[model samples]
Target: MREVDHIEQLVGKLLLLVTPLEDRRLHTDLHNFTHQLSCDRISYSAAALFHIDRSLLTSCIAAIAISIYLVILVEFGLPSLTTSVNNAYGVPNLSEISSYFVCIVMNMYFFVIYLFDIDSTLQGPQKTHTLLSLSLWTGLMVLRLVILAYSSEMVVQEASRTQRLVTKLQMLPVPASSGCQEELLLFEEQLARSPLHYSAAGFFALDLSLLKSFVAAVTTYLVILVQFQIPDTNKE
Candidate 1:
């Protein structure tokens, strides 16, 4: 994808910019310089990782904002015929729809970045701990994506079912108001008890809790990226 290429190029440029001396040097200088470059690269790589992770957070925030907008539209504006029909079928407000969309997009973004990070780690020299951390993070992200997808699908299915029930109610010669009310309440309770709902909530909580880990990982990656020169131990 274009976005992936762009990010790779940006990271490459950043590493190049931060790299130290390139000229061939005495053995001592080379050794010391190599060590310095490695240290610096680690820091730079960590910073770059932080930036990328922040982007994900920003995406989440954007989705939340859209959901809020939808809620406002549904609650306060002049009700359109389409909205009325949707409401009759128990279609969720704009916020719920927006939330689902945002979750899907974010999940995809996380997947891409996880792959990129894994590839980078594989292609370059990385410590055992770094590799392990990246692997765990990637796994967690994948799990989150799966959970999000499942949750969104469940919500959509529930919405469809509610719509059908409402339509059937509308067709009755004498409206079964009491029955409809009881059915709606049961539906709401079922939704609350759904595994998908719990999974979504858990993933959301996990992601929020991971902010600190994300920051640390990005910091480590940046450090690895920027420092390139080999160092000399004898000179020291």
Candidate 2:
């Protein structure tokens, strides 16, 4: 919610800080778009995969860091090629080296994706810009599933327990005229109608635990892949 507030402030500044001396038509269009934007809360989702919230940026960067780890594993951990084909060429096979380089390059590229994903909040009029934003949005959403998972049911259970505890506290003895009781009641009422979480197509809720699960899953699979490949490479 605070992130949304910062986005509103940014839109406000862009609209208010424009100069009349600049390209007049572009400025007018920007003002109009920014005005429309300021009036509503914008939500970005990627086809039920994940939300385009600030946390997503962090998750993406972490995933890229994991990929970098994979690249290092491939470079130093995997045995080198030992095929007769290499002897014929009299040149060291550079495919693994090239792939490691590509991974490094792509890690930087993913950061660019993260930047543009954040930029999507500041939407514009161009169709191309919108398409680019959605593309990045989709990519990240898919990444969320590929790199993470969590039991939404666990989160829902904990939240329900916490809410119950809070409501029960309101029953505690307190000064009759104290504002604390009134504030607690108001808070309870406000939360009563709202579900305690956000889910993906009703399948499960999203939370930080999901990111942890994703990292763990990726690591396990990578280790298995390396273990299986080592024997095959040894035989070769």
Cα lDDT tens digits, model 1, 140-235, are 654554454455456656656755674564454422322434444444444344322222222332223334444455455444432321122123
lDDT of 2 by residue, 21-130 (tens): 86677678777776776677677876645677897787667546645644543343322321222233322213322333344334434334344452233334563564
- Quick one: best lDDT, which candidate? 2
TM-score: model 1 vs. ground truth:
0.24
Q: Scored by Cα lDDT, where does model 1 land? A: 0.43
TM-score of each: 0.24, 0.25
lDDT of each: 0.43, 0.52
Cα RMSD of all models vs. native, in order, equals: 34.3, 29.7
